[model samples]
Target: PGRGRRAGSRRVYGTLEDLLGGDIFSDFFRTFFGDFERAAGRRPGRRAEQELEVTLADAYTGAVKPYDIIGPDGRAHRVEVRIPPGVRDGDVVRVTVPGLGDLSFRAKVRPDPQFERKGDDLYVEVPVKLTTCILGGEVEVPTSTGKLILKIPPGTQNGQVFRLRGQGMPRPENPSQRGDLYARVRVVLPTRLTDRQRALFEELARLETAETYAGAR
Candidate 1:
């Protein structure tokens, strides 16, 4: 059993992996589920919501998630939720209750350790060596699917953002169209510099100082 997390008006059980099923769903899984309802209609007897926590991978590719709800008979009834691709956090999936109105399943997308999602776009911080930032070089960038080589032009500064087209999350409305992935440059400085490196840096510093002095004049 995993820890419970509060979602909206209900408390949900299971860890991120247990609920969303984990990274094994990396393949391009076709979504059979259709668009779900976002708003609920006025009903006389509506059951309290049961929350579901889904992973980014699960949201990326639609998967069937199993859930249990208390039936009006006071028995736990298990149902498999057909999750469509590109489902975002806060989107509710309505489950049909034999007699009691509809049971709501509020989706809570588990936060990714390496990526931050905004709408359909994804943002990631890519670490680039100081030398690579100074001189033109290629750095491997992590995407939802895999790593791609990103060329950092010469004089690329720290915090510089690069957009990789069609790399972000797929839109629920249109699975073929994707937003974009923003790769922010995080310049990593060397903690320990070799004697040769120190000497070269010293020479570069002298050159910069000379250039500044000349500019002042």
Candidate 2:
């Protein structure tokens, strides 16, 4: 009778071990955890944000960029990002990946040396020769598209602003519409003057004084 009792105890212990170490236990825990998460209104994954730096030209022309991000499993993933035209700085782009939560990209536009942007307008300083400022002529001006020859009016003063329509940055909302470009004139004076040039200026100064002061006191 004792031997039978010992055999029954061993059988009960073996069954308990099998129950604890089998797929049934795993399924039970998974269901419990899933139900708990649903009841708590929580998700199982995380979201990530990253920053991408782009040039002003790229923002104007649009481009395909690539990025690498770290995954939850400590692995690296390469992602290709499609950038649209007319994306301003501080714009946020969202991308979704399968099995992963939403990924956000914050855009940062780099500064350009030739132009200063304000809203949709672009400002540039174009140097004009002193002779061109005094005498009307054409000067080469740089634009987003290409170089343009701009006519300078006679006696154009330094710091004078000239507006070129439809030559500025594209509007972010509507890329087909563009803003204006303002080009400020910067007069470049002659540093070294020849003897004949100095003599001619002196003669002109004397003539100016006599012609203007002859009628005055």
Candidate 3:
């Protein structure tokens, strides 16, 4: 569309005109030939890929999302892309740019605040009170959809992990089957023990000591 000139400075980005050289008319012919070759089932060169960042939710369920990209003119331009379901981080997705060929987009899936993904599995840490760990109780756990109650067995140790089947991310190609979710326990210690609490713990400690002595004997 415009005349081409020698580079006065390094170009940050440009259209086919920057790469093809000469005026828009010349570049138009070059693009025409390139598209023609592509349609004929041949590639002219290596395809270029642009990085796109998408929300975790969008990547999880797949959606047509609008994103802004900086153009060669240094202005933000809005473009829409169809994100496939179960698109993991660094996965590339094809994009259709008008009059442009041999280009794609690589998706950067944002991290979820509550869940950490490994392959298809998900992991989350839940805080369990000391009393709950010792006496057994139910604690609320965070999941993709909502909260669920996780039963803690008596004598549950800190850092223990519990697995919930079919609660993790869905398979990329299959939505019916899903991975597992792991909840790691983080025991919360009691602070500023009261007189009765301290006495009870002291008695428990003595009892454990007596048991150990009897075992040794």
Best by lDDT: 1
Q: Write the per-residue lDDT of candidate 2 for residues 20-118, one digit (tens) a residue.
A: 343332322332334434533444452223457777788877766665443545344556666677788888777776554455666777789998888
TM-score of each: 0.74, 0.70, 0.68
**2 against 3, candidate with superior TM-score:** 2
| C-alpha root-mean-square deviation, each candidate | 9.1, 19.9, 9.4
| Residues 144-205, model 1: lDDT tens digits | 88899999999887889999999999898998988899999999999998999999989978
Summarize candidate 3's per-residue lDDT along 12-85 as a digit string, tens digits.
Answer: 12453443453333322333434444533444564444456666667667877554333444343445777887
Which of the predicted structures, 1 or 3, would earn the higher TM-score when compared with the native?
A: 1
**Which of the numbered candidates is closest to the native, going by highest TM-score?**
1
RMSD of 2: 19.9
Model 1: how large is the Cα RMSD against the reference?
Answer: 9.1
Question: What lDDT does each candidate get?
Answer: 0.72, 0.68, 0.68
Which pairs of residues clash in candidate 3, taking residues 3 or more apart in a chain or in different chains?
1-24
